[model samples]
Target: MAAPVPPPTEPDASARICPGDQIGPCAACHRPTHKYGRGARSPLCEYCDAKAVERLGRKLRAD
Candidate 1:
């Protein structure tokens, strides 16, 4: 038998944004996003960033 999978967890508040951060539209989703750390370079919203990380993780695990 296999174990049940856990539900996806939400990113922490710190992952969302920080003080004095810039806001802009996401390059991929065109939604408003806060520019923080590397996110400033990619301009991807938190949702899109999470999706992208999940996709990359799956691809890496498959290889």
Candidate 2:
């Protein structure tokens, strides 16, 4: 048997505005950054993402 085809869908507005590899601000901090894949208007920069992970670890430990 063959697999059924998936239905088409409209493209996201953000994806149209900011395609993959486009520079955008970090979600946590207002810092210009890239490397966020497609339509990421507010993606976290490396530093912030690392800090968030650290914070999460601490929070988990405290609990």
Candidate 3:
């Protein structure tokens, strides 16, 4: 009688953080960011996005 061979084992890959989309530069700050949908314009970085909101508030107050 012949014995069966065991399957090869591999290290766990789930622990690794992988981005499904490509990482590109942020439009406003040029920092590394995960790109969104295809054909979509680049988005602002975190700091720029927050600053935009603050600027909008200041503009409204000035009106």
Candidate 4:
């Protein structure tokens, strides 16, 4: 027997983000990361995740 498909539901979930064709912000820098590629789970497309990590280190060192 074939499996039944679930109908589409309304999008009201706060965490349910659906980027039609745009990339999300970087988790670390919180900057726009669309120039690189389509994504939003950290490790922005424009730059590497390490870049942000380094910046964090610098900030912590200052304090």
Candidate 5:
């Protein structure tokens, strides 16, 4: 009988780090992202991050 095949492995987390730009995954969408401005520690991609901020602003204004 033939042996079963092993499952494919995911790349190491370190491998996903962009070497030249030091970019990594977005915190919200998990897409690759890079630092933009003063909020360097944020891992969110621009669109999701903007949406998050907008949602917060709406909540604050509603209160």
Candidate 6:
């Protein structure tokens, strides 16, 4: 058997606190707010976050 290598980890990823920011299988539909400071939190891709939030807000208002 051969030794296995750990998956690559992004620097500062430990502070990641978003949903949509997660990529690949871990990617989610939404991300959390960036509180504390810019570097303290994880930022989702602008496009994904904006669209999701817009749609969600519209749905809620409609209801």
Most accurate candidate by TM-score: 3
What candidate 6 gets wrong by more than 4 Å, as runs, is: 1-43, 58-63
lDDT of 1 at 12: 30
Residues 1-63, candidate 3: write the lDDT tens digits: 834322212111221232545555667656555455555466654455556777785454323
lDDT of 6 by residue, 1-63 (tens): 944422334322323554444333213323332333333433443444445677786454323
Candidate 1: what lDDT? 0.54
lDDT of 2 by residue, 1-63 (tens): 944422223222333455456756657665555634666465655556567778786454323
Better of 5 and 6 by lDDT: 5
Candidate 3 has an lDDT of 0.48
Question: What's the true lDDT of residue 60 in model 4?
Answer: 43
lDDT of 1 by residue, 1-63 (tens): 844422224333343565535655566665655665544665656566667778786454323
Ranking by TM-score: 3, 2, 1, 5, 4, 6
On lDDT, the stronger of 2 and 4 is 2
Preferred candidate (TM-score higher): 3 or 4: 3
Q: All models: lDDT? A: 0.54, 0.52, 0.48, 0.40, 0.51, 0.38
TM-score of each: 0.46, 0.47, 0.48, 0.29, 0.45, 0.24
Q: Between the candidate structures 3 and 5, which one is better when assessed by lDDT?
A: 5
TM-score for predicted model 3 compared with the true structure: 0.48
Candidates in descending lDDT order: 1, 2, 5, 3, 4, 6
lDDT of 4 by residue, 1-63 (tens): 944422222221221443535545545444544423453355342233445556675454323
Clashes of each: 0, 0, 0, 0, 0, 1
* lDDT-best of 2 and 3: 2
What ranges in model 5 sit over 4 Å off? 1-21, 35-42, 58-63
